[model samples]
Target: MRFYTLFFSLFIFSCSEVVKEESFGDVTTQQPSIIPAIQVYASNTDTDVKNGILYYKDTPYSGVYIVKFKNDRIKSKSQYLKGIKEGCTNKWYADGKKFEQRYYSNGHKVGVHTGWWNSGAKKFSYHFNDLGQYQGSLTEWYNNGQVFREFNYVNGRENGAQKAWKANGNIKANYEVVNGERYGLIGLKKCFTVKKGQDKVTR
Candidate 1:
C-alpha cells in the first residue's frame, strides 16, 4: 500500500511539470516581441513604399495587423493571410486625416485605391480588377482641387481620349488613344498644328 501511494504522487507531479513546460513553449512561440514601427517605414523608400517588408519581432507579420503612432493614434492597419496581404490597408496623415486607402488580394493590389493631399483634397483615384489589371477611369487632381488629368484604361492599356487641364482650369492638352497608340490630334489649333503625312503634332 505504501509503495502504491508513493508511485501515484510521483505520477501526478510529472504530469503537472509536462503541462507547464508545454504551455510555456506555446506562449513563447505564438506571441513574438513587437518591434518599433519606425523601422518598418525606414525600410521603405523616400517617395514610395514597397509592401511585404514590414516585420514584427524580426519576423514578417502573417496575421491581423494594426500599427499605431507613438501617441496611440492608428497610423496603419490591415489584414494578412498566410503572409499575403489581404483586405483593406489604410494609412493616415499625422493630423488624423486619411492619406490613402488601398485594397489588396493575395498580396497584389486590387479594387479602388484613393489618395488625398495633405490639404484634404483628393489627389488621385483609380481602380484595378481582381487580376491586378487596370480596368477603369484614372483621375488626378491638383492640390487646389482642380482636375489635373484624366484617362481611361482597359486591361492596363489606354483605350480612349486622354486629357489634361492646367491649374487655372484651361485645357492643357487633348488626344485620343486607340489600342494603346496615340490616335490623332484634337487640341488647340495654336498648340497642335498637324502637317500632312507627318504623323506629328507640335505644341
Candidate 2:
C-alpha cells in the first residue's frame, strides 16, 4: 500500500510539471510583438498584408495591427476585420504628432483622408470613393501652411483646373485637363501636350 501511494503522488506531480511547462511555452509563443511601421509598409506587398488585408499563419487576422517608431512611440494603429482593413487607421509622426488619418471599408479606401506635416500643419487632404478611387478635390499645403497644390479628380482621373504653388506662395503650375489633354501654363512654360489617354500632371 505504501509503494502504490508513492507512485500515485509521483505521477500527479510529473503531470502537473508537464502541464505548467506547456502552458508557459504557449504563452510565450502566442504573445505578439510590436513591429515597426517601415517594416510593415515594406511588407505590404507580401502575402500577409496583400490586397489591403492582413493574414497570420495563413489565416485571416482580425484585430488592431499596431506599428511603433524606433523610440517606442506608436506609429500607426489600424483595425482589421476578417483580414480586411476596416474603420479608421491613424498614424503619427516620430515626435507623436498626428500624421495621417484615413478610413477603410472592406479593404477599400472610403471617405476623406487627411495628412499633416511634422510641424502640425495640414499637409494634404483628399477624398476616396468606396472603390478606392480618388473622388472630389485633392489639396496639398506646404509645411509653412501655404497652399501647394490643388486638383480635382472624377473617377480617379484628373479633371478641371489643376494648380500648384511654391512654398513662397508663387504660382508653380496652372493647367486644365479636358478629355485627357493638358492646356494652359506650367511654371511660365506652356503645358506639354498629352495624348488622349495620358492626361497626368507630374508633380
| Reference-based lDDT, each prediction | 0.66, 0.72
Runs of candidate 1 with Cα error greater than 4 angstroms are: 1-60, 70-72, 185-203
* Model 1, span 83-107: residue lDDT tens: 4666667778777788888877777
Q: Which candidate is the best by lDDT?
A: 2
Worst 10 residues of 2 by lDDT: 20-29
lDDT of 2 at 115: 92
Best by TM-score: 2
Provide the TM-score for each candidate, comma-separated.
0.62, 0.66
lDDT of 2 at 53: 58
Give lDDT for model 1: 0.66
